[model samples]
Target: MGRRILLTCGEPAGVGPELAVKALGCGVDFAWIGDPRHLPAGTPVAQITAPDAQVPPGHLPVIRHDFAADATPGQPNPVNAQGVIDVIARAVDLVGRGDFAAMTTAPINKQALKEGAGFAFPGHTEFLAHLAGNVAVAMMLASTNVSPACRVVPATIHIPLEQVPAALSDEVLEQAIRITHAALIRDFGVAAPRIAVAGLNPHAGEGGTMGRQEADRMRPLLDRLRAQGLDITGPLPADTMFHAPARAGWDAAVCAYHDQALIPIKTLDFAGGVNVTLGLPFVRTSPDHGTALDIAGQGRADPESTIAALRMARDMAALRA
Candidate 1:
C-alpha cells in the first residue's frame, strides 16, 4: 500500500482549510483532519466521509472535529483553541500508531491557540515534541532551487536575543549538528552532507574581538563533530555565509539563532520554503509561512508554500517507507 499522509488544517478561522482543499486538488493520497463544515458546502470531493477518510478525487477526505462556532476569515476565536490542538494530537496519534505514514500541518495562530486554548508551547515544533513524549527535535527550513539548497537550524529558538549567549552550549550545538546531518542523509537523501555552522557574533567574533562564543562555544563542537567523521565547517561569518559563493559549498547551514538562519531563506524563497522537523520518528513537515489571518478568507491565500510542504512531506514519507 502507498504511504498515507495526514493533512491537519490548523486554526479554522485561518487559511488551513483552504490550503487543505487546494492540496487535495493536486491528487495526493492524504486525509484532512479538521471540521468538515469549514469546507465549502457541497464541494464535489471524495472524502473518507468520517474521521479517517480515504483520499477521493475532486473531493476531500475529512476527519471531522466539529468546532463550537463557525470560522470567519481574518477573525480568530480563542474558544476553538482546543480544537486546533485536538487536530494536531490526533494526527500525531494516527502517525504514531502506524495508521498514517506522515503528517503535513497547516499554519496555526499561536496567540489564538494560547489565549483560547491555553496551549503552553510557543509553536508547533515544541508542542509536537510534547505530544510525542518530549522527543528532542529541531526545526529546519529548506529550499531546493536556491543555489546550494539551504537547510537551517537555530541553536536557540523563539527566545530573546540577549538569552542566546547564555543558551549557547557545546551539547546543544552538537545535538543540532548531529540531527541536521542525519536529516540531510535520511530526509533529503544527501549521501555526504556538507554543513556550515554560522558564528554567533559579527565577523565570527572578529577572532574574539567581538565575542568569544564562536571560539569558546561553537569551535569545540564543530571540532568534535569533525573528529566523528562528519563533513562540517564553520564559525564562519554570518553576513557572508548565505550568499551564492558561500552557499555553494554546503548542503545545510546551522546558525546560532532563529533570525540569523531564517531571514536569508525567507528572503531567498519565502513563498516556496518548507519547514521540516528533524529527529522525529515519523516524517512531519509544514509550510514555512504562517496562517495568513489577514487574508484568511479573501480567497487570496497563496497555496505555493503549502504545495511545497505537501511535496516535501510526500518525499520524506517515501524515504522513510
Candidate 2:
C-alpha cells in the first residue's frame, strides 16, 4: 500500500461516516476502517479483504470493523463504545505493521467512550500513545491552509488550568520540544526546525516579577537544549506568538497548556486544522475538532478538517516513505 492512509471511524453515531464519504475523491489513497452499515444511507461502500485492494471510484473502501449496534444520528450508543475503541486499536495495529503509510482518525467522544467502554485516557493522542506501546508523544495541531502555516504543541494537556504549573516540569517541556522538533524534520520536511516555547504565566512571568518558572526553570532547560544544536527560542509571551510576522520566526510553537496552543490555531484555521501526534512509530492524525453530536448526520458537518487530515497524512506518509 503506497502512501495509503487508514481512516478510523470515530464516534459512528456522529459525523465520522459522513466525513469518510466526503473524504473520498480528494486524491488521497485511503481505506475506511469501520462497519459500512454505520455509514450514511445510500453510501456506495465496497469491502476489501486486504488494505492494498482497490475500490471503484465513488465507492468507500471499508475494512469492516463491525459495531455491536446500529448508529442513531445525534445520539451515541454506549454499547457501541467498545467497537470505537477497538477500531482505533485495530487501525494502530495495522498501520504499525507498515501496511499503511499513515492513519487519519475521525473524532471520538471521550465521555461516551468512558461511559461505554470504561475508557481511561484523556483523548485520542494519549490513547494512541498507549496503543503504540507507551511511547512518548506530542500532540501537534497543524493548519497548512494558513499562510506561514501554524503548528502548535501543548506540553501539558487535558488538565485543570490551575494544575498546569505543577504539571509542566523540565522533563515534560523538553520531551515536547524534542518530539515536535523531530517531527518537523521527519514528517514536515523541515531540515532544521525552529521551535518557540510559550511561557506558562502572564508576560512570561514578567521577567520573574510575576512567576519564576520562566527564568528559573524554563530558561535553563532551553539553554541546555540549544547548546545541543537545536534551533529553539522562548519562554515567549503567549499573546505575542501567533501574528504572521511572529509565526514566521518559528517552525513550531510549544505552549504550556492546551488552551494556550489550541485557541490561536483554532481561531486561525478552525475549519482546516489537523491534530497530529508526533514521535509515534507510525504517522497519526485526526480532525482538530471533536465528534459533532449536535449536527451528526444532517450533512451540515464541515469536512474540511477531515479532508485536510487525510491529505496531510498522505503527504507526511510520502515524506516518511
Candidate 3:
C-alpha cells in the first residue's frame, strides 16, 4: 500500500485552510493535518485521530494540530509559525512510517516561518530533504490538466540569475536528470523517459555565439547520458522548446534555472499545476502556487492546484504500489 494521503495545511494565515475546505469532496479521500480553527467558520469538518481513521461523510477529515492563536483572515501571526512547521513534520513522520500514502502540502510563507521559528531552508523542498536525512530531491512543476502533462525541473532553483551560471554545474545537472529519470519510471510508470534540456543562453549558445555554457558545459554531459542509452535532446533554444509540438517530443524538460522551467508551466496551466518533489523516499507533492495572504479567508482561493495535487498523489501512489 502507498498509504493514505495526508494534507499538511501550510500557513494558516493564508489560503491553505480555505483550499483544504474546498477540497472536501474533490473526488479524493485524505486527512487534513492542521488546526481546525484555521478553517473557515462553519466549514464541515470531521476530526480524526489518525490517517486511517474513519471519516464522516460530507466532511473534511482533520487530524487537528493546534495553533498558538486563532488565525486572522490575512494577517499572519508569527505565533502560529511553529504550528505551521509542525504540521509538515507530522505529515512527514506519518508518511515516512508508511502510515500515509503521500503528503500534499499547501503553500507556506518562508518569511513568516523564519521570523517565527528561526526556520532555515529556502522552502518545503529543502526542508523536507533535511527532515528525510538530507536526501537529495528535485522540484518538478507538472500541469495536471494538460494531456500528457507538461512537466519540468529547474536544474538550479531558488538562486539569483547572476548566480545561476556558477551554480549550474555538471553534477547538479546530472543529479536533476538522474532523479527526474528515476521518478518518471518509479512514480510515473514511464518505461523510457525522453527528456529535453534547455540551454543556458539564447539559442543554445548558437554554436558558442550566444554563450559557451551550452556548448562547453552542457553538451558533453548530455553526450555521456546518451552514450549510456538515455534519450536526451539538449542545448536547445529555450525560446522554442515549450510549444505544444515541441513539448510533445519529451516526457519532461530540464532547464538551467528556475524561471526557464516554471514560467511556461505556470503560464500554461496557472491553476492546475502540481509542484512535485522527486527523489524522496516517499511520494510528496504540493500546490504550485504560494501562500496567498491577501486572499486568505475570502473563500476565494482556487482549489484546482490542491485538488490536482491530491489526484496526482493518488496516481503516483498506485504507480509506486
Top candidate (lDDT):
2
TM-scores across all candidates?
0.95, 0.98, 0.98
1 or 3: which has the higher lDDT? Answer: 3
How well is each residue in 1-321 modelled by candidate 1, as lDDT tens digits?
236678897888888888787776564677778887776556455545344454444777676777777787778888888988998998998888877778999989999988997889989999888888898899999985576677788877999998888787887888888899888899889999999999999999998899988888788878977998999889899999888888889999989999999999999889889999898888899988888888887678888888888888888888877
Q: How far in Å is the alpha carbon of 157 misplaced in model 2?
A: 0.7
The RMSD of every model to the true structure, in order and in angstroms, is 1.7, 0.9, 1.0
Please identify model 1 stretches exceeding 4 Å from their true place.
49-56
lDDT of 2: 0.93
Question: Model 1 lDDT vs. the true structure?
Answer: 0.84
Per-residue lDDT, model 1, residue 60, is: 75
Q: How many clashes (backbone atoms < 3 Å, residues ≥3 apart in a chain or on different chains) does model 1 have? A: 7
**Number of the candidate with higher TM-score, 1 or 3:** 3
The order of the candidates by lDDT, greatest first, is 2, 3, 1
How would you encode candidate 3's per-residue C-alpha lDDT over 132-176 as one tens digit per residue?
A: 999989999999777667999999999889999999999999999
lDDT for each residue of candidate 2 in 118-228, tens digit (9 for 90 to 100): 999999999999999999999999996898999999999999999999999999999999999889999999999999999999999998998999999999999999999
| Ordered list by TM-score, greatest first | 2, 3, 1
